[model samples]
Target: MNSQFNFRFSALLILLVATLVTACKKGDNVVPSPDLGAQVAGTYTYSELKTGGKTYPASDTNLKGTIKLTRQTATTVAIQLAIVHKATNETFADDAAEDVEVVESGIGNIELHYNGDTIAKIKGTKISIEGEDDAGTLFTLFATK
Candidate 1:
């Protein structure tokens, strides 16, 4: 009876080990999340073009800037933006950090709100981002790494 019990226990142990091994196999349905920090850390040259408004002269509608993206965490980034009007050479600057939502492997979105309205909308990957701010004035940023 003792020998029979030992054989049954050994067989059960082997079956358990086999089940665990199968559960940990590589081809299982589990998938690893992509690393977001490594994909969006860089300095990008940006241009802000304003149009369709009577706020400024046509010559002053174009501006240039530089945007820097620093990774704050796996799901957050720090944005530094500076823009200068081409005609008047006036400068506008803004700095903020936001927690971004990943849209896919290489895409993300960040929205900045002022008084419940989304003043700035940021969407991009590591290579570039399209930023738009709509607060009294309209400006769109085209950024490239």
Candidate 2:
């Protein structure tokens, strides 16, 4: 009778421990990504510009610029680019604020979409953007806040 009782008690204890272990299993603690539009909404000055395999630094008198980013929504931002060409004293600028969508947000970077195409990325205080002009000249702008 004693041996039988001991066996029954051991079995019950083992069952209780197993149940507790299962009940205390780790849960899925999913954390959502940050809102990149709001996080990166600020003015940034051009650090460099690349086009047609030619690189222009910000110190280049003819191709210096700034970009303004305004948060319009949790996932959208209004961007205006203003670049000045000193030789001609011509200012190339967006006549109106263009709406850009923040399509993807990750741990260290955020991707931006313009006109249904991915054209920009923001990491830390820097933004890199690629675009083409009406003449089909491809360009990339690197800016920092």
Candidate 3:
């Protein structure tokens, strides 16, 4: 009779513990992540440009540029580029902002995509973009806010 009572008591205690564990809510204390688009929205000046195994600083007389990023929506960012080619004394400016989808790539990294292609990556206050011109000159731009 004593062994039967002990077994029943142990079973009751196990059931109580199981119920308490399952009743507790998860993620109640978890902090939500910030919006990637909003976090990266700002004006960034080009710090460096790389092409043909050569790097040009922002102060380089040949090339300079600035990029403006605006948060268009929760998952979208608009980008506008203003660039100057000193050799040709020409300026390239976007008449309209291009929309790009911002997606979280990792814990602290975000990627910008346009037309199903990744055009840029943002980490902290820095952004790196890769593109080619009409003449097929592949270049990478590193900018910082």
Candidate 4:
């Protein structure tokens, strides 16, 4: 009878311990959004296109090359631009480096600024830079990861 009673108490204790352990299990916790600078840091395929408030394929000589962007701070980045005219190999922005600011808040649109001017807008995996050259030739750069 004593052996039988001991077995019953031990079984109850085991069941209670199992219940307590299961009750202490953790639940899923949500993760926060990633930083804008961290997400945009990488290499990209840079395409130079004619600009009429939109992108259009132009000659390969319209400054065709890759653009490399490296994050320097939460609101600043170092840019390495290398572009060339395929016909004459006339390079534009060849190794031209600049530090630009990233505006991420207050308007809800992520934009890259150079000299307090909006140089590019970041959307998803794409970045578009629209401006004129030193000769006043309007062009747009579409870069994608």
- Top candidate on lDDT is 3
Worst 10 residues of 2 by lDDT: 89-98
Q: Could you give the candidate ranking by lDDT, starting with the highest?
A: 3, 2, 4, 1
| Per-residue C-alpha lDDT of model 3 across residues 27-120, encoded as one tens digit per residue | 4656776677788899998788888989888787476678888998878889987777867748743433567999999987899898898878
TM-score of candidate 4 against the unseen true structure: 0.61
Per-residue lDDT tens digits of candidate 2, residues 1-145?
9999999999999999998887767443455666767888999898987888998887863667788889988888988878667577477544335678886556777887878877678888888888776798888888999
- Cα lDDT tens digits for candidate 4, 1-92: 99999999999999999988777663334455446666667776775475666555534434567767788876677777666776677876
Each candidate: how many clashes? 0, 0, 0, 0
Ranking by TM-score: 3, 2, 4, 1
Score residue 74 of candidate 1 by CA lDDT: 62
What is the C-alpha lDDT profile of model 1 across 56-114, one tens digit per residue?
33335566677776776665556677666666777765655555432333236644333
Give each prediction's root-mean-square deviation over alpha carbons: 6.5, 3.7, 3.4, 6.6
What lDDT score is found at residue 103 in candidate 2?
A: 68
Residue 1 shift from truth in candidate 1, angstroms: 18
User: Where does model 1 exceed 4 Å of error?
Assistant: 1-21, 26-30, 47-50, 53-61, 98-135
Off by over 4 Å in 4: 1-33, 52-54, 58-62, 95-98, 105-109
User: What clash pairs does model 2 have?
Assistant: none
